[model samples]
Target: MAGEYGLKRYFDADAARLLGGRIRAVQPGFDVEGYAAEVDSRIPGKELKDRVLVLAEGLRTRLPADYADAVPVLLAILGDELAEGEGMFTNSWFLMPVARFVEEYGLDHPDLSLDAIEEITKRHTGEYAIRPYVEQHYAPTMERVAHWARSPSHHVRRLASEGIRSHLPWARTLTMFVEDPRPVLEILEPLRSDGSEYVRRSVANNLNDISKDAPGLALATALRWMEESPTPETGRIVTHGLRTLVKKGDQQALALLGATGGEHVRVPRLSLTPGSVAVGDTLLIGFDIENTDGRAHRVAVDYVVHHVRKNGRSTPKVFKLATLELGPGERRSLEKSHAIREVRTRRYYAGEHTVDIQVNGLVRATGRFDLRT
Candidate 1:
């Protein structure tokens, strides 16, 4: 996998060449080869993430000592707006090292870091780059971030929510936000109904990250957002934000989303077709659900397959079927076909596998299937 383009050529000599040319275009006196050489020398065999800082280190060594001056040169080379279509984020890879350098050295003059990041994000993203800055200067830094939530550019608004994620992937976590996310939530609240799907997704992802460790706060926020004013965009945001807890069959999350409250629901018929399957084959599971209560009930029907692993053990994986409201004394029939195949993330072993049907968050029926290579 490391031999593939995602990592193998991401920071190779060719990348350095283009990056140097761009920088040299902005600052004619800039040393291009020196920067490229350092990038290449330190980049081979290293993963892409390691190369980002290495590129930043190269810039540190070869660029002007004045961070303010050097930043403008980088900014000048960046396009005025994010690229459209194929090469998106490609041009911005250069910004990673630029932001990394600022993360480490811009503590003394925090305003410069703020300025550089705000400008840089328009052409790419400062989400990962701004984490350390926020961690170091929480009060002043987030004040600016909170202001960014209202910016004209959705990209800037996204940075406002993204940079403050407690568990941002490929970036350091904001520990303060992890402990107390009020400030970050304050930034996100206004943007819940943001017009752009891009910004909305980031806001939702931020909430989802918060949900992992602070489910109550996340649920409260989602419920409030939905109850107060849930636009199509905001509705999508809440749905995605609650996705993790829903997958885990969290009863509170289920109930909050109106996908629960099925105390009188029953699965009278549940079975796997043929009761046997082979690796690389497909299995169909069918079920009949009845609502017995004298009131309407929302049911989130899910199925769990206990997969057999090579170590002679099994792990349960949940698959969502449907979320439909059922009237009193009503019955609904549903079926789903699941494929068992060799996947990069899982290895299948021959064994008897168990399956269960869940209503709301409760498992209501169980069945079994055999799997063989």
Candidate 2:
């Protein structure tokens, strides 16, 4: 059914007509039918993002040729700011094409574009559109972004962090920030204790992106945030930001989260029900952990699945299991069911797969399952 689902369907002919009508309402003598035809002709078979680009291109041809002249027309169509907790997909879905228009055409007009981005982000997202400005006009753009980091609107504040992510998904990577994340970190400083979880989550994701390239920097930043601002918000940010490092069993990261003394724990058994399964079947994993240390220990339990590749080699994927505080000699039983199904991100292969029980950063037990195609 996922294959059956197409995001481009939302931008079908009817959407073109609605957008055309909106443009006509704001600017008399606008060629509504011509705009609709332009978008409708090229949209079929195009993907979601491509469909959005088609709409943007249609606007570029139909609207005023000058970037500054076109901005007011584009802004006039933005209805209102999205309510708190409202996503861009629902009410502001039409703005996707509009945002893309700015990204494609508004580079030389930074002041106009940035102003439009600020207004557009309140209703939709300026995250993707703001990237070009950050890339082309680094200093002044980031100055405005820093100002946005303190904006009253959480959406704008979120953009301040989300726009400059080193590896923002669906957008080109910001290599400048990836090479040196100090500037991005400075912008994230004030937002560490932001009241909005939405903004804080973006801050976490930005740090997570940084961690992939600059682990030490991310770790030091997380530790500093924990020391300076010990709020629940910052704690979540640090925990999420250091997730990749923790999964790799980075001892310093484990210790920072109090998941220490992992080597002192013992997993008496790791069992797999239905040791063999087909692609659509479910595999049940059961394990018991005992804290063998003399003192109480905080445990971060995880499981690793070594999936079979086309070449018969195995690639390990980590899945979080549990986090608990265990008194000395305390024992706990845990059960997890994993469904082997079809998805876009990964393909399933038939072979023997190894599963490991990892306590903190240490592997305590291992088991195997045979997958049949």
Candidate 3:
């Protein structure tokens, strides 16, 4: 293949050794001549596709029923071999087969405990690309995480985050954590102030994941730790974990940062134009603020939209607007736009809907609206 694509010289020693050995042992029938011819014919500007295709073809022919069992050794060695210079692994096309193998193998292994699962997942996470297996096996995977939390290996500790990250690199979204993050939090709480920066970073990311689903929960938990007189290091860890959400209008989140809602910031006039907007309509939210404090300050805006479910439970969805930088006695005008859309899991009714703009994590402005069909 390299010869055909004019990439014969580009075949590094590692690639040539592995691909050559596999060819000689597994497929004496393999067409080295055909591969060379194809490589010679390969054009420039198609390096990525051509290289990936060659790897995929090799994987498809060699993958076996017991592939999952062999994956750890292969990945431990080969994954580092395949990783890019920046330390990030690429999702080669052969990833799905590995996922399928684990899925199939795991189904019959009901007795597999957390520790065993971690051994496989840690090895294959970025190499065999076993994210689907990780997501599908979250319960056991998390149990493994709890066990690993006590391990002495930083490598294993890092896996705790790499495995369950909502946005794990080049992997599927782990939405289960988005709704209920308790299990993941359990694994992270003990490691929040880990002596290793590597482990601490993972704990911070796990907290960040929780912020997406329940910002208040994340903030409250941080507050609970703070109230317990967290060590300075733990305080820093919690603060870093909440950095994004606090900047994004988690009121309780900012409170952890020492922002006083009512003392330094005040809203004299706050309004929303066309207080009512239906699906496919735009809601223009405006906030007018006054900084009464003697010094300059940055006040963030938070919006809580009252969403009434079909079951009559009203839930508040909060969003953060721009950061308003105000000078002493200065007034500001800020506008935000939101497009209303139908809720997939819930329905909205035509009624007096409520919207409020909060300043410094405090509700300083509010208005009412109607959602018509």
Candidate 4:
């Protein structure tokens, strides 16, 4: 039988052998067998991030004890920069541990480590690895990151935005940026209309993270970006960046996205088909919305699934449904199916669940369903 699917499988013995072999090629004195064995022994039963750390630790043991001395070897083994807008994870996943090694061991050597991270990110990703430097060596790192924002390589440019995200996934939160995002905003300025969509998307995500903490600031920034550029690309970045605020129905956010006149829409009927479902079943939700206003209006329709938690309390998750314009007296019917399936991120509890039809951030109608264990 095939083994269960997991991220850890990606960093198993074979990956260690590959990484060890690369290190051996660069530093002929490197002990490939011992390094591979150490990673193989420590990796079993560890989670994905932990497994990467294990590989990093193996490198620590085999590489030269001095961080400065080790820098040249790591750089020599980086191979080549990924093609523009490619290889965040697909191209060189093995380099994750190499980046991690720089993160864990290269802190005291900010310039060297930053240089290494810049090169590593070109091939794989230094997003996770660069966080500590931002934390420990704030001024210098941000200065370097600002310079990277203008790099010729899209990968390096993306690192400028992605590396400084306040809540980058799989990485520690940058609380300093969360509290005061001015620095991050400055770094993102040049990247607003970057040539690469890959880089632009990171800028949007970074703005999204900023929105979570400082909605007003995020809104203001989005508005300014729109006013300054007003290009389709800038519009996409602003819309995605303000998604959380838009979901919460922030008036300015909705207005910026042209999802206005929510109050003039009426949901005459909302139905959840077969109101009860067990895990792994699909539930169809249908609703009819009519424009009550005499003038045409843009509508941003969304749904909220208030999932029952293990404690019996519920938390709301907003899902995007549709965005359309309705003329005077126009009516539209929309349907969406939601599958209640097992996933790593969430657990479903058997109980009553609530669904709300949200238009332009305002809840127009609500319904309920029972979930069976």
Candidate 5:
């Protein structure tokens, strides 16, 4: 069973050793000491996934129904190394054991209450995975989160903002709140002007999530927040959050930020070497850009490969071409080769496949030709 697990394969040795020290300090047992010694003796940067797996297995079987004993032991272990005074853990690794513990034993202790839930929330923003269990096990406890929003701890306040963000980047989707973010918005309204940048960034990211599915709602919220005298901190948060909308040229977003399109920087001419590609063949695509604009312009150049399906459903996938910093009247030439792979479902239409060069999110040039089977 341990051989099949990839957790240890992915765990970095350095991270494990660091985590092991903390583990040895908190989790008292013969195995923990043995594992810690093994990890400490290993070359730095070795991963501890296997050892953690062993620890997890031990807990799953040994942990009793009354988490009272296990809870304090874990808290003291976490508290000694990670959690000092204000509810901050020592490191992200500290969350691994706790998360594993929660995943394995959460339902067993259905009586878990508000205080325990709050303590776990302080573990990490990525802890959102445990929200369903929290809501199921401790409904009344989660409700009290609104009250804790006013707590002086930045950690608690951040949890209020971040814990509910609908689209936390790189995290799993929170579809429920993304649809109607009202409950969380109440928590954000007060924390928007939070004294800590930590809390403010979370608030901004939360607003950013609201922007994706509901652009109109996001713009309205931004406008509403703008009307009030915004602090510099709040302004930064709002601006960063609205970056996507601003790039997509949302009118309200542009007007509120008082930003408009600048002079169109002259673009370069593009050329493809083969000009045509065969399935399983490599196509070399190249481009030359001459910027005649007097001022320097930053441009993002990319290509969209339009693939025609067997059933004639067309889908385009964007791939990066280049990011250029062109100076006044500069000429730059770039080239890249793309391989054509014959996928099982893809049918070559025996006609021209279109591709276009995109400049800073705008399509500027077009090229097309046939792909032979």
Candidate 6:
């Protein structure tokens, strides 16, 4: 990146040295400096994985002619570099680059690539790398991944779910899983009670990704996991997995967790303070709810702010409030502050923005605020 730096630096001079040394250690005569120069020239303008592939293209030329011979040689070098305690961003951070390397260099040879990818995942992770194999060899690759769900290595178990994420951030989308995610749930079955939190979090994220395209599959998977396991660990997966669906006010998702729909609840008041605010200011939003029926009710209350974009159109983004039970005749006032700060993901435009108070997935009250430039 020209302006600032982040993950792009993961492949730098040090990584070049480490990779060059490993290549030479295994293959007697290799072009280390020429490989280093290509890496240097390619990295100047590219981001993390973009630069990784740029260098991987150069790296492929220097390896042995045999695909099967080259794959294990690289895997052996990676094993040599592994330390006892390697964090995601540590010295062993080389796995991410190595994964991309395999994705590019070893596509023609699935079996060899699969073997190397499994070894890469056990220590760091081959989730991003495994996608190509899954895309190229769908059924067989997934069969191997399913078995990894039961692997003694938590990292391998994590890869079983993470590698197949429908919408994995910073990685290519797995279209097979996106079109039909039933197979993904099959992979998650063995890891529902995974002893490691690392593996469980991966499963939750994979399920969450499934919710974007296949909400039904995501919900069904969560329900089935809960029914089969019925444990606190499995319950956590449901809460995290259905979060996006809950944000969209999916009635089935709300009902799954016990929240009353808007029609069933009574909203007597809704208001936003300081009708007009500056670009980077604070706006206080408040609303009041009352339970009308004789029995208590569980509710998932949220506020949807329809932010105006530069084109004069607006999109709705839901923010969660409180989830609680209201007894009969009991009224509660809930206030959540809105920070009108600038965010990289969302650019704020000067215009009239509307905020709606919602119960379950229903809009009970709407309020407007003018954002001043």
Candidate topping TM-score: 4
What would the TM-score be for candidate 5 when compared with the true structure? 0.61
Superior candidate under lDDT, 4 versus 5: 4
Residue range 1-373, candidate 1, lDDT tens digits: 3222454356766677777788888778677777777777878678667777787777776778987777777777766687333222565665566667777777888898898888878877788778877877878898999889999977788899998999987676778888898888899988898877788898899999999889999999999998898667777898889888887888888887877556789999987987778877889998899999888888888899899877888999988888889998999889999998876467888899999998887888999999888
> Cα lDDT of all candidates, in order?
0.81, 0.89, 0.59, 0.89, 0.61, 0.81
How far does residue 132 in candidate 4 sit from its true spot (Å)?
A: 1.1
| Worst ten in a row by lDDT for model 6 | 80-89
lDDT of 4 by residue, 1-373 (tens): 1122365688877888898888888888888878778877888788888998999888888889999988788888888778874655667878878998998888889999999898988898889889999998988999999999999888899999999999998777999999999999999999999989999999999999999999999999999899999899999999899999888888889998998789999999999977889999999999999999999999899999999999989999999988999999899999999999987777999999999999999999999999999
In TM-score terms, candidate 3 sits at: 0.52
Pairs with backbone N, CA or C atoms under 3 Å apart (clashes), candidate 2: none
Off by over 4 Å in 5: 1-30, 33-58, 80-90, 107-114, 120-126, 134-142, 169-172, 247-249, 262-373
Q: Over the full model, what C-alpha lDDT does candidate 2 score relative to the true structure?
A: 0.89
lDDT ranking, high to low: 4, 2, 1, 6, 5, 3
Model 6 lDDT tens row, 1-373:
2211455776876677678888889887877787888788778867777777866776667777776776766787776434334555565665566777788777788877888888887667788888888888887898899888888777778889998898987777878777888898888888878888888888888889989999987888788777888888888888888889988889898888777645667788888888999978999998889887777888888899899989999999999888879887678998888999976468898899999888887888899999998
What TM-score does candidate 2 reach? 0.94
Query: How well does candidate 4 match the true structure in TM-score terms?
Result: 0.96
- RMSD of candidate 5 to the true fold? 8.1
Name the regions of candidate 2 deviating beyond 4 angstroms: 1-9, 29-37
Tens digits of per-residue lDDT for model 3, 192-213: 7677776677677767767877
lDDT of 5 by residue, 195-218 (tens): 877778888888888888787877
Model 5 poorest ten-residue lDDT run: 80-89
